[model samples]
Target: MMNVLSAQDKQRWRQDGYLVLPGFFEQAATEEMLGRARQLLDEFDVEGHPLTTFKTEADGEHVGDDYFIGSNDKIRYFLEPSSLSKPAPGAPSKLLVPPAQSINKIGHALAQLDPVFRKYTLENEKVANVAKDLGYHQSPRVLQSMIICKQPRIGGVVPSHNDSTFLYTDPPSAVGCWIALEECTPQNGCLSFLPGSHKTARVSSRFVKDPSGRGTTFESVAGVEPNEEKWDELDGWVEAACPAGTLVLIHGNVMHRSPPNPSDKSRLIYTFHMIEGAEGYTYDEKNWLQPTKDMPFPALF
Candidate 1:
């Protein structure tokens, strides 16, 4: 494995809860991945897709339908809520544009199912090395992967929250890798993060399946209640706008968000979460996402 993170980078990660590495991936690589994503979007049939709109709200509520829950090991497409229009009362919603232009994301198992995504995810040694450098000394596994297509005019907003709230594990060890497939700008809803919030913020709420097994919802973590103060009001927030191929490493507890893209262009990004898989670190069973017995989460090494 090659050396990726330096001492300065490590320090920055500890102090800021995130690190941005410009040009971490080459232009050719990003373009190839982006092209493949576009191909997949173009080929997807939305005729009978159930029209599951992907929603993540500012209040910590998220979409927890069967489609979202069952996508742990399968690649699936989700629609943008803003792009759907109601033609009549008591009727199903219809998309305003073509399927390719209306999709909000393709997610949950791209790395495991698609060879194009796998090359940059599970097969990327530089990423694995970065995990090792970040203190995944015993074992680390890729938990979830997704391609977020911030479509022009209809892309939704993602509220401020930490990744660990969605991908919880005992002792709270999860890191996020965000790769920009296209140029990200403030006008196109680039990510904004609260620096060093990881040190003060706790994973107060968790996204988990209901005990009845019908759906999922957010549950308060034991002894950690939600803060009355809003996270967005905190100081030292910084917006990250970078060119294609930039990689951003995010600590699990860092508070971050991206505004809705209302521009003429789209901002495409690929993101995956990693968790400690070593002994003594337990993955929560009630977590909305789970690995099947037939197909477990693959380790980095």
Candidate 2:
């Protein structure tokens, strides 16, 4: 299988701070993923458990908005695990994997069955190569998952922000892989990004209201103030729309957000994050970032 990114692609990533690998997964893989998701939902329902939960108020005041089924509680949880399964000792403590075989199957399948999917992760060649190119020797770390299931009337917008601010890391080196499980279009609240924002220095953190108004606004970490008119400056900024199985890779420092799903159908997406190594970083019990590393990449990958 092809394992390396083309020089042109690398250059584009360097220049734009993001890259879109359209149709990275085949129809077969996409269908399989959907099947797995359906099975998980059924299992959760059979057990009288919720298959989807809210990751943020942006998901709206419904059970399905920003729905995430299976094991990933850090993203959202659908069911509680049975006694047959249990969480790992000192596992990230995010409740990402519920203690159930059916739910665990989803996580396991995601980690093993899909190479193209796996390649976007921190351990993947592209990430490692990027880290090395940037003078880091360690591989990036998987931060969290952002799963979305947009509702029709209630679908809410995710405001612009940088992911780096939420994560606590030094020399901030992280990226996000957003995989569309269903067709996404402007009508369905597709994601939009500001190109080259990641290459800029980190900006001050701020708080903004979540579109759904479920509660307090999500704390935004890495976006410039509106007065900066950052979006107007990026000629390459594009609204991302793609069919199922498309993957959008973005820098952690990049500014991005999505609008409400105004369409009749739901829009499903899964986003994951990776960072280069675990050293020189500190986190509180809440897993929020605290200061640690003071220097940039010191070693080559």
Candidate 3:
């Protein structure tokens, strides 16, 4: 098969732990994805769980464990405070009507649930080539698909985090393909990644299911010390200002984050995470999410 990423693209990803593939997908394809994403939001009557660290300020209470463990083959919504309108003046102030746009993200796992996503992920030759080029000589396990709409004006800041901390595999294989469906700008919000931080930084902790299965918790590693000055120490971040149809490859351990969106416009993107799924590699048992017996992670190669 032909390589999806050119030699130069691979080199860029190697040197920086990330790479930007500008205009990767066609404009029509991105438009179709954006349209499908919006349509999915209209299908669900229920709002989603804001699963961010800053979710205390979100509209709903903390997300229940069932959402993470049981939503393998379903489409759900996650809200950003910006999506919903504030209570009307002089009214009860308790019931906030669904604002102009009231869904911040569409999922934590999507390809396994939706046909459109599944078709593109499993059948698209181009996508498979990218997976092959990423050193996954065997089939790649493609999971954790989401359409994140950084809503205008009130999108919260996403703190820097490592992908492997959440999706840790035995050999530590986790890579994220963040695709911009709409223009991602510094004015709205775009990802900023620290160059070459993955080599030295360690996974300090992991978000996992509690032993008793009551709720989710972060289990900290015994000896790993938090590196507060790491981002500053490594040449700082490179903001990914990409237009629609662009793809950004993010390393599993690279430190990355995005600021709150303060602009009137919105930044919409679709993201998928892949990990080595071949034998000899095991998914961490303690990780907060797992495939229910009915739905399992799919293959792409």
Candidate 4:
């Protein structure tokens, strides 16, 4: 494979824990993705809503009733009729929606066509390579999409935390590519990351409930001591203000979070994970672990 990442870019990713790749997609691709997303929302009768988060039917309730209350019609479109009436197989009370296989299929195709997605999926091989360098060989994993449509005066904040907490994998060989489908600014709750925080030796296992109240935070697992200076230095965290089509590649272990989208305009973004393949790696099927054995690796463009 051709080396898409420069030496400096790799170094920066290793040291800073993330990289900002500007113009990762052309205008046409960006517009297309946004269009497809809108069409999907329309197909599901999801419009004029506050916020939307998509999860498998098995995990739907964990996503909360707030996402489904006013948008029942939309929710029904994505979920099977049986799912709405009966609970998912494993999680009855949780209201988990079975995996939206169709949505995943569409998203996978879009990822191949979108420039920003292609760049991260194809050009940015550094993440997997780095894991190999570190002695892990796992393939890429596509987790889930987090789509948000912030209604006027209805947005909320997402506290700062590392993604590593939610994902459990040996050797920690996963990276996520977050692409902005709309203009993201500080006012719109753009993502913020703690530069180079992935290299930290500690791994916390705190259980911080997500909006759905089922997820846990990793900050408690690592048990990292707070350093005022380090916090202050990272406090100068940069907000990724990019036009649609900008791709932000971040380490799985990096500390990151986003505020609420205060703007009326929706902030659309998709996140995908990739890993290097090797033996002796174990995955937790019971827990939502990234790069699981059953989940297919993200397609390399």
lDDT of each: 0.88, 0.52, 0.73, 0.51
Q: Model 1, range 19-82, lDDT digits (tens) per residue?
A: 9999999989999999998998998898879899888873445677899899999999998888
Q: After best superposition, candidate 3 residue 64: deviation in angstroms?
A: 4.7
Error of 3 at 214 (Å): 3.8
Residue lDDT tens for model 4, 56-132: 22112333234432221122222222223345787533223323211211232233344544444454565345334
Root-mean-square deviation of every model: 1.3, 10.4, 4.1, 9.2
lDDT of 3 by residue, 1-301 (tens): 8868878877778878888888888888888888887777667564244332224221123344665455556666656654444566855222133432566677766777777776566777887888788673376787778888777777777767778877777667889888898899888989898888888778776666778876566677667776666464466688989999998988988888888889998888888888888888888778766766676777776
Per-candidate TM vs. native?
Answer: 0.96, 0.61, 0.86, 0.62
Error of 2 at 131 (Å): 8.4
Model 2 lDDT per residue over 1-301, tens place:
3334667867877777777777776788677655555554444432433343333332123222233312222223332222123448854223333333223122312332344444444335554554444332255545454344554534566666676655534555666667788898999888888877776636454222234543223343444443355554557658888889887777777878777765777676666666666667533322232222442222212
- In model 1, the worst 10-residue window by lDDT is 56-65
Error of 1 at 130 (Å): 1.6
- The runs of at least 3 residues in candidate 3 whose Cα sits more than 4 Å from the true structure, single-residue gaps closed, are 47-64, 82-100, 222-235
Each candidate: how many clashes?
Answer: 0, 8, 1, 31
Give the candidates in order of lDDT, highest first: 1, 3, 2, 4
Error of 1 at 84 (Å): 0.6
Higher-ranked by lDDT: 1 or 2: 1
Question: Which residues of candidate 4, in runs, are more than 4 Å off?
Answer: 46-138, 145-152, 206-234, 289-301
Number of the candidate with higher lDDT, 2 or 4:
2
- Which of the numbered candidates is closest to the native, going by highest TM-score? 1
Candidate with better TM-score, 1 vs 2: 1
lDDT of 1 at 258: 96
Question: Which stretches in model 1 have alpha-carbon errors above 4 Å?
Answer: 58-61
